[model samples]
Target: MSGFPPAQIIPPQVLLGAYAQGVFPMADQGELTWFSPLMRGVIPLDEKFHVPHGLKRSLKRRPFEVKWNSNFRATMQGCADRERTWIDATILESYCLLHRLGYAHSVECHDADGLQGGLYGVALGKAFFGESMFSRKTDASKVALVALVERLREKGFLLLDTQWLTEHLQRFGGEEIPREDYQRRLKVALGKQDGTFHPPALAPGV
Candidate 1:
């Protein structure tokens, strides 16, 4: 087996720098792949995003339901199961460590019978950095995100970083600012006191 088979450990400083620069690393078939997408996706705190009418109605009805910090491992593993994934054994373990510390967090959505829908990342600071999310049901991921935005706004969070933009995110008021602007936001957020999240990472004031 090649030396690459083992998950290469990325230093915390390196990962943090990647977050500051709006970039992240992933393993592409055992090779390190770095990404910084041009159009970053993010939900504006004050904007109204259009959720599909059907989903909105569904939310009013059964409301599959959303919660924070409830099943971190399941959500992370779900995100890692995509066709091509970066959350290899080493990376997953590292992020779990981050979760244990006061760094990483997950916002989870569940169905009527308590099945996971999707989840996103949360790193406290002026900025709440969002990682990837997935959904088993139609509005699962989207509703989960809406709840996150609501929580962030309530918590007095300064920046909500989504890294890069996407069309699905556009319907939810996501927009792309220049890289320089992004870096500036990150710099301040990283420096200022933004609170912390450890295991039992809960919504603000929880």
Candidate 2:
């Protein structure tokens, strides 16, 4: 039986344009695809959702530290570490390129040991397009997210776009809104960017 060829490489310019237009690329199997979902998932920083009791307890127990943009490449690699991940080598390289262009970001959660859980994504205007997150310990990622949202809100960011919603996200008040509504929110968020946030100061372990 015959097999597939390979996924087409998305031009960097095209990727940037797509993001600017509220659309993005995806790949189902072997094809590079673009999509603008009608129903968008987002977490409003002002209306921050509740932290689960178990996670809250976890946070208090471990007291993990939060870091921002400390290791962009490391965070991306960690998130893409899983065996069945959608983030291939090409996509990883693309994310790194975006970081170099001042469009990508990474939020790290760790402790006195080393890296634990965290997230990474694109930062355009006032919107934080969260791409993916990984958790090596419970509530570690949650603390990182809480700190990120606080910092964003403090620094005047307007939107936290998670792209698609999940049960895990629901705890953080992630909600689905109509495409038009989302676009409207995006407009406001993008318009309210301040472009400044404090960097993390955590050491290799702490």
Candidate 3:
């Protein structure tokens, strides 16, 4: 797919505008490409939200200490440490800038060793565009996700846009809606944005 030329400098607000328009960026061979999928994947925060029995059990075990925005750079690095990733130096630097501006945030899971798993994304209005997640310990990322959803629900967020669905996300009831429908939802969500990613009280388990 073709994309707009990468700007000489990508300001954090520019990135936020892209997400507000329902598009996001990916890096390939040092160039940035934008995407707005025809079939968009999202995790509904409504009554249909489901958690697997195994993960629910893990939550009670309290395997990881969940933290928010404490180590945004480290969480992004962990997601990029994999063998194949779209998060290049350019993307990394830009997102770090966004985080500094409080428009991008990370939900991190840690054990005694330090950060074990986490995810990061951009928050605009009432929507969270989940970017990536990684785990060094079993259920570490899952626990982070649980905490993320609970927080979103508490904050009155209306949407959690995952961009795409995977087997990993499917277990949490990820579903795809047509672009038109997603755009409608996006419009409503953007209007409702409160300019905050501040999470509310976490669930009792963790």
Candidate 4:
């Protein structure tokens, strides 16, 4: 990964433009920074995408009610609720604006107790950037991930960018590719006009 200091406030257009070029921002030690990794992590949107046997069983149990764009800020907070996080105030505010503009979204899992887990990310053309996810209950975040993949597939999305590969994501077919290869795929995804975060035929429930 390579990075440089960024402005305190990243405009929505700038953020979208950066995503188009395969760069993204994070907050590090209260400072904004931009990075484009040498190897990019992506989750397959096709058949290669996997749901582990255990998670498949959890899916059947319907542990939580899945919803889209419901409590987006809360979902971001969930992802940021860890001990050390990159989702600082500036990152939070910028992404919230993106959500308002319909470029950012959340996949939430809720139960009788309240919000259990979820994820938040940015959607542009046929690409969806998986920023971060958090779980408040067992498998709640995993369920939300499964639901997100299904939704993206239903809407004909072609790319699922994870930024970096992690062991947690490898089970779900997440892999890292050279930045050049990633940029090529990103271009193809951005060129397509049919993909969208929200489609009229689909409701928020999953």
lDDT of each: 0.68, 0.72, 0.83, 0.85
Poorest 10 consecutive residues by lDDT, candidate 2: 197-206
The candidate maximizing TM-score is: 4
How far residue 5's Cα lies from its native spot in candidate 4, in Å, is 11
Worst 10 residues of 3 by lDDT: 197-206
- Window of ten residues with lowest summed lDDT in model 4: 194-203
Candidate 4: tens digits of C-alpha lDDT, residues 42-74: 999899999999998988989899988889899
Distance (Å) between predicted and true CA of 64, model 4? 0.3
Candidate 3 per-residue lDDT over residues 5-86, each given as its tens digit? 4434466666887888799988876678889999999998987778999998989989888988888999999999988888
Error of 2 at 26 (Å): 2.8
CA deviation > 4 Å runs, candidate 1: 1-5, 48-52, 193-206
Model 2 TM: 0.81
Clashes of 4: 0
Instruction: Give candidates' CA RMSD values in order.
Output: 3.8, 5.6, 3.9, 3.7
Model 3: runs farther than 4 Å from truth? 1-9, 192-206
For residues 32-67, write the lDDT of model 1, one tens digit per residue: 667776555566777554566766787787566777
1 or 4: which has the higher TM-score? Answer: 4
Q: Native-vs-model 1 lDDT? A: 0.68
Q: Alpha carbon lDDT of residue 58, candidate 4?
A: 88
